[model samples]
Target: MDLSTLMLLCVFAFTAGLVDAIAGGGGLIQTPAALVLLPQYPVATIIATIKLPSFTGTGLAIGQYIRRVRLHFPTAVLMCITAFGAAFAGSALLTMVSSRFMKPVIFFILAGVAVYTYTKKNFGEHTTKPYSRKKQLWYAFLISLVIGFYDGFIGPGAGSFLILAFIALLGYDFLHASANAKLVNMATNSGSIALFLLKGTILWSVALPMAVCNGLGGIIGARLAIAKGNHFIRLFFLCIVTATLLRLAYDVFVKN
Candidate 1:
């Protein structure tokens, strides 16, 4: 990499580490940085590089969240299987279709999700669960399949959105939902990484330092958020998701 690109990558990697550690949308930081810094880079490589740091960031985030938030193993397992399979299929199919075609619709979807969460007064503040295992499982299945496929295909903010869906649909508090999102999101990233490895597009040099920094960031961020408690995390989540929505919306309608 050139000096400019190297500097850019370093900055992006650090930002990604911090953002991902806090609320799990680090890809939104690093992927676009790759696009802008390495304009000549293949789209495939851009995608693969994203997974390298993310895997590290999320691996740490997962451990941190699990330490703090109690998990429902059965639902997490179901989510993992479905998400991994769906993401693999989605990534394979992604090359065949143009993601740009869906940008407008996706913009609307992001706006709606952001608005929905903002409108809810106590959405992520506290746990208020009331359900049977069977009911939660159905939502978990849908979340894994839908979000996982989207993650593999488009590859941004997948973790945050998964958590939101888990909270809204399953009535999980933000903390538990975040823990669950980590499990399912791991599968999505793993699946996409597997496909990218097959494509031979990853650059280990760019990915290695990024992964280490991201891992440290994840550990620090997760611990801080847990210590700070629900209200701070919820607001922080809102800020990142809203920022992502704006960026994606602009990328879709204006930039295109």
Candidate 2:
């Protein structure tokens, strides 16, 4: 890649990290940016390359969240493990099936999420356990398995879906949900990146510098979300979800 193209990818990665840290739609930005930047590469290669920057940024965000926000360690760990395994399996599935069939389904699901979140004013505002510890763990496992697979196979708004699931199923507030989502997302991204590396699919030349910028953006965005608190995160979450829904709609309905 040329210096200009590398810089552009880093810029997009930074933007993606910033948005992703707050609301979890970074792939909506980074994936398209990668497609534009590396048009010659296969779609899977671009997806794999994007995971490197995303994983780096998410790792930083997870660290910041662990330090500042309270985390449910047991649930988080269970979900992380489930997500790791599920994502690896999903990555393996990517070699067998095309993801195009999944796009419309995901688009509809994101639309439902947007509508549900919009209509419910106080959703994700306060933390309260709707389920017992064991039940919550079970729910977490299910969520990690489904969404982590989606993340590895055809990621766009996986983080948004995770945050919503954490809020609705576990009764976490937006801030706490976001914190847990970051850790799970980090695990999923790590699994995908490992698989991509094993397959020799990622472009290290572009990913390294972008990873640095993405990590920096993650730090800034995480701190900002911490300072702003739950209300801000909730609003940002809605916006990102809406944007993601629209983007997916365009891709599924208009682009193809």
Q: What is the C-alpha lDDT of each candidate?
A: 0.81, 0.89
TM-scores of all predicted structures: 0.93, 0.97
Model 2, backbone clash pairs (residues 3+ apart or across chains), number: 0
| lDDT value for model 2 | 0.89
Off by over 4 Å in 2: none
Highest lDDT: which candidate?
2
Which stretch of 10 consecutive residues in model 2 shows the poorest summed lDDT? 125-134
Index of the highest-TM-score prediction: 2
- As a TM-score, model 1 comes out at 0.93
